[model samples]
Target chain A: MIAVMSGSFLQRGEPAIMDKFHRTKAALSSGVDIVLELPYIYAVQNSDLFAQGAVQTLHEIGVSSLCFGSESGDISRFTSSYNVLQQEQPAYQTVLQKNLNLGLSFPEASRHAYQQIGLATSEMDLTKPNNILGFSYVKAILDHNLSIKPLTITRIKSAYHDQAITGSIASATSIRKDLLSKGHISETAVDALPDVTIQQLHTYKKQAGIWHSWEDYFQLIHYRVMTMTKEELAAIHGVDEGLENRIKKTARSATSFYEWINKIKTKRYTWTRLQRIFAHILTSTAKADLQPFINAKTVPYVRLLGMTKTGQSYLNDRKKDMDVPLISTLAGTKNPLLSIEEKASHAYYSIIPGEKKQTLHHQELKPPIII
Target chain B: MIAVMSGSFLQRGEPAIMDKFHRTKAALSSGVDIVLELPYIYAVQNSDLFAQGAVQTLHEIGVSSLCFGSESGDISRFTSSYNVLQQEQPAYQTVLQKNLNLGLSFPEASRHAYQQIGLATSEMDLTKPNNILGFSYVKAILDHNLSIKPLTITRIKSAYHDQAITGSIASATSIRKDLLSKGHISETAVDALPDVTIQQLHTYKKQAGIWHSWEDYFQLIHYRVMTMTKEELAAIHGVDEGLENRIKKTARSATSFYEWINKIKTKRYTWTRLQRIFAHILTSTAKADLQPFINAKTVPYVRLLGMTKTGQSYLNDRKKDMDVPLISTLAGTKNPLLSIEEKASHAYYSIIPGEKKQTLHHQELKPPIII
Candidate 1:
C-alpha cells in the first residue's frame, strides 16, 4: 500500500537526516507503492495529533486497511483500548483533568486516568510510546466512522526512547543519536536499514552534511521569548497556566536549548510536550492559526509526496472517485492548508545553518517523487 | 549636540561591529553630548527614509539645530535643492514618474527629475550621497514646518562608498569591508577611528567575534521568497512593479544572497532598494503594518541610546517642552512604536549565528548607556 510519514522535521523537532525525497525513493525501491508526506505542521507534533493527521489523510484517500508497528501485535487489545477511550471519555477526561491539575504531564496523566477508569489492561499499559500512538490511530478511525480496518505488527527490538541500538530493529531515536554522535551512520546501522535507504542517507550526508537539530533553533526561540511579553506568549497554543512566564524568565539566563528546556520543564510538562509547544512558539503558530485545522472533521486534502508507476495508475483509475484534492506539487496552489505548510517549511529551512542551505528543499518548488 | 544613529544593523543591512551600548559610549566619549537610536526599521531603510526618521526623531525631542556631514558644506545649495524638490513638486513628480517609467532607480530618477526642473545648479549636482540625504533632511524639516535650524559640515578624507582606508578619516564602509575581508581591523584602520570607538569594537570582537552581514540572513530570505506569492512581496514597502516576479524567478537558481540580488537588480531598482525590500520581507513588514507609522505626523517617540551627565541635564531642562515620549528603557513600555522596535530586534537577533547569540542584546531589556 502507501506510507504516509513525517517529512523534513520529525516529532522531536529536528530535521530528518535523510530528506523526504530520498526517503520516498528508498520506500519505492522497497515494497511501498507510494509515500505521502504528512505536512510539517502535523509531522512535528504530539503523537496524538500526529497519528490523527496521518490516519485521517490515509483514510480520506480511500485506503481500506492500515498497519502500524507497536509493542504488542494483538489487534483486539488496541481496538478494545480505543473503545474504552471512546466510551469512557467523560470519566477518563475527568480523571485526566484532575491528574493534569495536579501537575502531571499529558502522557503520565493519560496513563493514570486510564488506570483509574479500570478500562482494558491494554489501555492501562500505556508504557510503550508506539502503543499509545497505535491506540490514537484506531481511535481516529473509529471516531470518524471510517471503513479502514487496522492491524499492528509487534516491534522486533528497541523501545521508542531507547538511546542504544538493539538487534536488527533499532528505534529511529537511537539511529538519530548515533548519527549525531558519530557524525555519520555506521556500517552496523547501515546493515539494519534497507540498501536504498543507506544509499540515500549517504548521498545526503555527502552533499549537505548532517541535518540540523533543535539546538540550531535555540537562539531564535530564546530571542523570541526574551522579546515577547508573557501575555503575548500566553496566547500561543500550549503556553497556558503561567508557563509563558517560566519560559520567558528561563530563556534569559539559560545559554542553550537543553538548559532552557530543563529550566522551564516541570512535572506538568514532559520534555517532548514542552518542545512541541516551543516549536509552536518558534514558528509563531498561535491558537487562532491552528484552531481551524484542529477542529476540522478530517484533513481537507491529501499531499502526494511520491508514487511508483503502479500507484500512479491506481490513482489515475480512482481520480474521479477521490473526494479531496491530491496535491502533487505546491508550486501555485493557494489552499489554506498549503499556506500553513509553506510557513512551516520556511520555519524549518530557516533554522538550518551553513552549506546545508544549498541542499535544503524548498517544499513549494519541489515536485513529488516519481519512481 | 545630539547624534541619532542606527542601532544593531546599519544601512547596508549588516550587523554593527560594535553593539549599540558600546557604540553609544563611543559617541559620548567623542564630541556627541547625547546619542539617540534611530529605530532598526528606519535605520536599515534607504537614505531618504533613513534621514527622515533620524531628523524627525531629533526634531520631536526639541532639538533646535540639525547638522550633518556633506560633500558640499554650503547651506544655500542644500536649501535650493530642497526648494526644487518641494516647490516644483508636481512637475518634479511628473519628471520623476517619467524617468522611473524609463526604468531608472529612485535616486537616479530623482536626480534626473531635479535637473529637468532647472531650479538651481546645485539641484542638478546630485552626485554626492550625503548631499542627497542632506536635501532630504532639509525637505523633511520644511514639509513638517519644523523650527529646527539646519547646518552642513564638509566631509573629510573619504567618499561614502570608498573601499580603501584613506588618510586619517576613512569611510565607515571601508572599515566594515576591511573587517569582513581581513578578519580583523588592521592597526592602520584602528588609527583612523577614535580611541573610544576602537576600544568598543575591540571589546565586542573579543566577546562575540565579528557580526554578521545580510548573507547570514540569505537562507531566511530565500525561504521567505520561495514560500511567498508575488503579491505578498509587492506588499512590502520598497517592492513594487514586477520586481517581485524578478526576485522570485531569480531566487530559484541563485545560490547566494549576492547572486540572488545581482540576478534580480534592474535599472528600475538599485541594490540598496532591493536589500531594503528584502529586509522588509524578512521582517514581514507588510504595507498595512507601515501605513499607520507613515501617516503619523512624526515619529511617536524618541529613544535615548546613551547620554553624558551634562547631556542629561540639557534634556531634563527641556523635557517639559518635548512633545513626544522620550523612552530610555523599553522594560515595561507598551507604546505602538516599541512594538515595531521589538519585532525588528527579534528579526535582527534571530539571524545572528553561533556564539554571537550569547552576546545578542535584547533591546527592551537593555538600559540606556549613561556615561
Candidate 2:
C-alpha cells in the first residue's frame, strides 16, 4: 500500500533528525510505495492546517482511505464528533472565541468549545495529542467534502508525548529524546525503530555529524528575535496579540531554547503555539507570504520525494488523471510555496558544516528518489 | 584636556575589549577630563564618516585642538594633502568613479584617485591606516570649516595593523589580539596598557565572563544573512551593488564569520568595508535610519559616557553654551539616533549570560559614569 507522511524536514522550528532524503529512503524501504512531501507551509504549522494540507494532497492523489494512529482508535467516534461540530459551527465558534478571549490557548479553547457544543464524548478524548490530530484529519475530510474515507489504528505501548522508550513500539517523541540524550540511537530506542530506520539514522549521523535539535537553532532564533523590530516580528505569521514584545524581552536573557519558551509560555499561548510562531520567525515566513496558500482549494503542487517499484507503477497508471503537477526537481519551478520550501531547506541545512552542507543542500535540486 | 575618542564600542564590527562604561572610566582615570561618545551611527561607519562625526562633535563641544596619532607625524602633510584633494575634487571624483567601476574597493579606488590627482605625496603615504584616518580628520575639518586646530603625534613602536604585542607602546589591535588569544590580559598586552586600563579589562572580563569578538558574533551574523531575503538584506545600510546575493550565498556554507567575509570579499570589497556592512546588518541599521544624520552639520546630541571631577566642572561651566544637547541618560529621549543606539546596545549585550546581560544593557539607560 502507498504510505503518505508529512516530510517534516523542519518541525516546530527545529530540523528533523533525518532530512527528507534519508526519511524518504526509510519510508520506501519500510513497505511504503509512494512518498509525497507535505508542503513546508503545512508541516510546520498547528494540527488543523497540517491535517488539511495532508488530507487535500492525499485526496488529489486519489487515495481511497487515510489511516492514522490515535489513542481512541474508534473511527466512528471521530466521525460522530465531526458531524456534531459541523452542525453546531456557529455555537462552537462563539464558545471558542469566548474562551480564547478569556485567555485560554487555542487547543484548550477549542476543546472547551467542543464540550459546550456537546461534541466531546467519553468515547473520544480530544485532549490526547493523537486523538486531537485524528479529529483534525476527520474534520478536514468532512469539511472539504472529499470522497476519501478516514480510518484509525490504536496507538500501542507508549503515549504520543511519552518521553521514555518503554517497548518495541514507542512514540516518536520518546525515540528522539532517547537519541538526542545519548547523541545516538540508544539500545532502547533501537529496539523501537525499524532496522531500515536505524540504518538511515546511522547514515545521517555519520554524514551530518550531529542530530538537529532546538538547541542547534536557539542562537539563530535569539539573533532573529533580538534583531527584528517589534513591527517586523508582528508581520510574521502567528505573531499576534502583542506577543512580539514578550518574545523580544525573553530572548534578551534566555540562555537556551527551552528556557526561552518556558518564559514566554502562558495559558493563552501553549508551548506548541509558541513553537509554531518561532518556526515562522526562523523561516521569515510572513503572513503575506502564506496568505494565498492559507485558503487555497488544494496545495499548488505535490512534490514526489521518493517511490518504490510498486509506487512507481501506481503513479505511472494515474499520472494523467492527477489534478496537480508532481514536482520531482526544484530546478525550474516558480511556485511561491516551492520558493518558501527552498528557503526553508537552506535554513535547515545552514547549521551543517561546509562540505556536508553543500552536498545536502544540493539534494533540493536533484531528482526524487526511485528504488 | 578633554578626551574625544571614537568610543570604539564596536570597532570594525567587533565589540571592544572593554565596554563603553569601562573604557570611559579608564579614560577618565588616565588623565582624560570630559569623555564624549561619538554617536553610534557614525562611530561604526567608514573612516570618512567616522572622522566627520568626531571632528564635528569636538567642534561643537568647543575643543580648541584635536590631536590624533599618525604614521607621518606631520600635521602639514595632512593639511597639504587635504588642500590639494579639495582643489582637485572634480578630477579626483572622475578617477574615483572610474576605478570603482573597474572593480576597485572604495579605499583602493580613493587611494588611486589621490595618486592620479597628485595628492598622494611622499610626505604623507595615504596607504598607511593612521595616515588615511589622519587625512580624513583633516578633510573633515577643512570640508566643514571647523575652527578646531588639527595636530598629529607620531605612532610609536607598532603599526596600526600589528597583531603581535611587542613593546610598551603597542597598537590597540595588538593588545586586543594578545588578550583574546590568552583569554586574559597577557603580560605583553599588560605592558602596552595603563594600570587603570588593565584593571578595567580584568573587571569587565570578570563581570561579563568573556571577551567579545567577531567569532562571538559569527553565528548571529550567519543566521541573520541565512534567513533574510535578498530584498531585506539589500535594504540594510552598506549592502549595495548586489552584495546581498553574495552575502546570502556565502552564508549558506560559511563555517565562521572570518571565513564568510573572506569568501564574500573581492578586489571590489575590502575586509574593513565588509565588516562595517556586517555591523549594520547586526544592528539592523537601515540606510533610511542613518540618512538624516549623514549630512547634518553636527550630531543631534553628544552622549556623555563618563567624566572626571575636573571634567564635571568643565561641563558645568560650558553646558549652557553648548549648541547640542548633552545626553547623560537615555531615559525620556526620543531621538532616532538614540533609538538606533539603544538597539545596538541590545545587540551588543545579547551574547552575555542572563543577569549580566540585563545589567550591561541597563547601562544604556543609566546616568553617565563619574570618576
The model with the greatest lDDT is: 2
Q: Which ten contiguous residues of candidate 1 chain A have the minimum total lDDT?
A: A118-127
Error of 2 at B149 (Å): 2.2
lDDT of 2 at A202: 91
**B44-68: candidate 1 lDDT, tens digit per residue:** 7767678778888988778889998
TM-score of chain A of 2: 0.96
The CA lDDT of each predicted structure is 0.76, 0.83
DockQ of each: 0.27, 0.42
> Which residue ranges in model 2 land beyond 4 Å of their true spot?
A7-18, A125-128, A163-166, A181-188, A331-334, A352-362, B6-11, B163-166, B177-191, B202-209, B329-334, B352-362
Across residues A157-237, which tens digit of lDDT does each residue of candidate 1 receive? 678898877757888888777767787778768766778887888886665555557776666666567555566689877
Clashing pairs in 1: none
